[model samples]
Target: MMSILKADLLKVKRKWFWLLVFLGPFGVIALQLVNYGVRYDYLMQQEPDVWAGLLDNINMFVAPALLLGMTILASQIAAIEHQQSSWKQLLSLPVQRGYVFLSKLAVAAIMIFISSTLLFIGTVFFGIGLHFGLDIPFLAVIKNSYYPFFAGIPILCLQVWLSVVMQNQAFPLAAGVFGAVFSMTAAFAAPDWIPWKWPLLVGEHDPIWYAVAGMITGSVILIAGLMDFVRREVLT
Candidate 1:
């Protein structure tokens, strides 16, 4: 499994996969930069707790970015296999099929985890620069930055499953796009069972509950996808 993961990591090195990871968090911060840039005075005056306000603003876009990022990351990873017709070659080796599936999932999740860390660092630095004060709410920032990723585990699993099973990347890509769009309104309209709503902790349940639920749900999806992937014939 380690060897498989190392090889998969090598395949993606010097590739656009890294760029997407970097961009995911940077894009979120860049947009916030412009937002505060335009109304620095008004925003500062309107909000008593600027850090909270900034985090709130940043969190608003995090869910959509996360959904879209996972979609593209999964598609790109799967594309490498599909485009090169390498699945059969890789699967023919002595490794279990489950390892291959899990390795790919690990790569995607690692990238997303890095993106979340970047968001935390970026938010802290950006908040400091904005003069939001030295008394930062470390807990709040952590929640805003990391909670969504934890809450998004199911999405990562589902997107990867979709990408791996379908030879046609368009279908998986389309589902991802739709998921991103749905996530924006999910807090208002989606039910608790909707996976898209988990990231934002829609319905206002305990924040930690969303993260816990995401892991449990993600595991089920991941296992189901794995079983199907192992059993399904690869004709191409």
Candidate 2:
């Protein structure tokens, strides 16, 4: 298990992965700047309450960025293994498939979590610099942020499984894009039955019910993915 984890870490340490990590935060910053620019005149006219503006920023921009980043990170985790034929080589070792799958999943989840947190921090500080000119209370931002991060775990796990089993990066990425789109659609269209609502929508004024539902649904999906990953055949 240690060796498997080490190998996974080594894969994540490669140049391409670091580049993605670096670029991910900058992408979030760019998006925030665009949003600020587009809405600045209106925002200043209204002079909306600071909390409201902060929440709006999170809902309109930060949540989607985190979800997209997690999707890309999760896809890359399994895609890299398949691309380098490391999956086949790892299977040749006398290790349990469950261990291998879990290790990879852990590495991916940890990396995504760290990256998302950093992106959130970066966006908040950027806003401070541009808007308020001072770092203010971020408790509301931090509190509201937990739902999406935790809610996304199941989606991340499922994406990892898809990337591992599908052998085609394009399909998984396309699916992720669809998921992001569907999340917004579901928020307004069905609202009740759309499981995608939990992980993709964030910064709601009242999100208790959605947060609880997200936790339950995310757990179910994660467990199902783990079972499938452990039992599925690895064909080199």
Candidate 3:
């Protein structure tokens, strides 16, 4: 199992994967900074409200980048097996297929979480540097920022399952793009009852109950995807 994980890490060491993992969050932060700058004059005129500010920042910056990054990470992990023709090689190893799938899922989820953390840190730093004031509740920002990463687990599993099943790079990437766009749209159009709503929309009104529910949904999807993958017969 450790060897499988190490092998997966080696696969992820490629330049493209690191580029997406790092640059994706950096780009999101940069865009958020820009948006903040554009709204600086307006925000300055009004008293800073922590919850409102945090929500605004999330809506503008964090969610979109997070979903996109997770999609890329998930797709690339599956792509490594297909692109390098190592799927069969890995499968033939003595480890359980479930273990192999879980390892990949773990790595993908960790990478996405790391990227999300970086983005959160960058946002905080940007807020401080710009003198956005300490009016923002540190706890609220931390909670909202971290919650989606957890909520993203099921989506990450879904993406990995889709990537593995399809074995085509483009489809997974497209799915990621579509999921990111759609989640944001759905959250805005009618937040209630949308599966994509909780993870993509972060704010004070974002109940802990909803996040808990999202976590459950994500976990179930991931487990189901893993089971499906384990039962799948690989021709290669």
Candidate 4:
């Protein structure tokens, strides 16, 4: 498994996928720059708690950015196999198909986690640049930026599954875009039922409940996808 995962990582070392990881979080923070660049004083006054206002602005784009990032990550990873016509070659190996799926999943998770971590750092840099103060909201920043990752497990699995089942990136990418759009509304209308809304739900009242639900639900979806892959005779 480790060998396979390592092989997968080496495949994309020079790809644009790495750029997308930085772009996801940096793009979100970029919006905040414009928001504050034009009206730094104005937005600061809106909320007495400086961190609240800054976080609010930062959170606005996190979900959308995350959605797009996940979409591209899944497509890019799947493309590694499709473009190289490596599926048959990989499956022909003595290893169980499950390892292949697991390798893909691990690679996807690591890529996103690194992106999310970069996002946290980017957020902090932007926050400090705006002079929000040295008394930072450490817990809030970490929670708000990263908790969504746990919630996005189902999304990660779904995107990966779609990518594997369908060779063309269109289906998976489209699903990701649609999910992001749906997330904006679902976060309020139906968080519990919708995985897309889980990331944005971090700022909500009693977010832990939703996060837990997302984990459990995401696990089910992930397992289902894995099993489906194991039984998959045709690699798209």
Candidate 3 regions with alpha-carbon error over 4 angstroms: 134-136, 202-205
Per-residue lDDT of candidate 1, residues 66-152 (tens digit): 999999999999889999998888888999999999999999999999999999999999999988779989999898888899888
Can you tell me which runs of candidate 2 are displaced by over 4 Å? 131-135, 200-205, 208-212
Best by TM-score: 1
Which ranges in model 1 have alpha carbons more than 4 Å from their true place?
A: none
Overall lDDT per candidate, in order of appearance: 0.90, 0.68, 0.73, 0.82
Indicate whether candidate 3 or candidate 4 has the larger TM-score.
Answer: 4
Ranking by TM-score: 1, 4, 3, 2
Find the candidate with the highest lDDT and give its number.
Answer: 1
Alpha-carbon RMSD of each model: 1.2, 2.7, 2.4, 1.6
- Candidate 3: worst 10 consecutive residues by lDDT? 201-210
lDDT digits (tens) for residues 23-62 of candidate 4: 8888888888898999987887799998878887787678
Worst 10 residues of 2 by lDDT: 199-208
User: Could you give candidate 2's per-residue lDDT for residues 90-196 as a string of tens digits?
Assistant: 77789988788778778877776676677668757876777674655576666555556666666777777777777778988888878777666555665554656
| Per-model TM-score versus the true fold | 0.96, 0.84, 0.88, 0.94
Error of 2 at 53 (Å): 0.7
Q: Tens digits of per-residue lDDT for model 3 on 114-203?
A: 776776677677777876576656666666677777766667777888887786678888878887887767655755555555676543
The per-prediction tally of clashing pairs is 0, 0, 0, 0
